[model samples]
Target: MSDSKAARARPIIVFDFDGVIADSHDVCAAACRWAAAELGHSDMPEKPFAELEAVTYEALAATISVDPERFAGLVCGALEARTTCAPIFFGVADIMMELSRDFDIAILSASDSDLINDFLITHGIWHLVKCVMGRDVPGSKTEKLLALKSAHDGKFVAMIGDGVSDVAAALHADVRAVGVAWGWQSARRLRASGADAIAMVPADLLDLIVVQELTEAPTR
Candidate 1:
């Protein structure tokens, strides 16, 4: 294929690192609990994973009457340690490798950039990604998506995540939003959050991407 054609054929996929790629739900919950206690919010009621995943880190901290920045630090520290032990979900590496062959993969996550990078490197898939916009990054995921859209003008973009914020960002950026059921939010919650589609498993995600590529392919 010609260079232009090849570029046109490839889609840009942005992923949320935590719940989408890594099975970090428990790690996140533990971190939240720790932060709550350490920050003197131990009396705060425990929230369901779906509810927690739906809110921004700042909002979650605010709900528990804790300082967002300090809570974020605690969570980040705990998450980094947990991920160092075991990060990537089962079969994620293989699927990421396959997707990288036909897509320009990127990461837009609320997790710390260093932690995300460490997890990706540990799993040997860091090289597969083209960009990573983390919480430490300068802007929100919506802003990051807009910048990516401007850079990759006319190319199809999609965001795969397990959070309501991901879907909201995708909507704000006018891109495809795909939710994963195996992550932090349940499929029902993801659906209610306005995700375009939900993948029940890793293979299902691959199939969803294929279908989206075909559906969005430009007419000759």
Candidate 2:
């Protein structure tokens, strides 16, 4: 890229949903089990998450002679609420508060858009975020981040998440890559990606995000 083009791609942050935003594994797993139970899938294990990865609402309902459509709606309704109701990782609130002072903050998540928005809105951080990188309402994660770059004027952009897909975006998006450990993937997995930086905790993120705007409130 030319120096002139490089100047336009600024440093900004993107986040992952689920584990990064809130510890939603339990909530999501429980919701799935509850939905399965409602469908009379007696075969479902008592474990909240053991079968969650394999059991979609449609599949569970089919197994129990229930209407998939109706059960899906029920699952969505119940789980969406849980999106905003989970526990925030320790020190995340403080780190977000501090980081917001410097960097251009945004949500670049692989999770569903409504889920991400709900989590942010419930926690009152929705207003703090200027943009969101949600997976396809009708598009992919790559599309969302590209759009985010198009909308900003910063010289650097960052893909911050706990997955390989996020690494792909960092490569495809032509920006620096970052990994966070408070999410689904392991730190070992992230480090293996050869990312630019790996944040073991949200508080560690402060060191990378703060540039020269410590005293200046980030552009809202």
Backbone clashes (count) for model 1 = 0
Across 18-106, the per-residue lDDT of candidate 2 in tens digits comes to 66767776776566667767766645544332222222346556655778777667767787665247777777767766666555678
> What is the lDDT of every predicted structure here?
0.77, 0.64
Evaluate model 2: give its lDDT. Answer: 0.64
Q: lDDT: which candidate is best?
A: 1
Candidate 1 lDDT score at position 94: 88
Candidate 1 stretches greater than 4 Å from native: 1-10, 44-48, 81-83, 212-220
My TM-score estimates for the predictions, one after another, are 0.87, 0.69
Number of the top-ranking candidate, with TM-score as the measure = 1
Question: Where does model 2 exceed 4 Å of error?
Answer: 1-10, 33-77, 81-84, 211-220
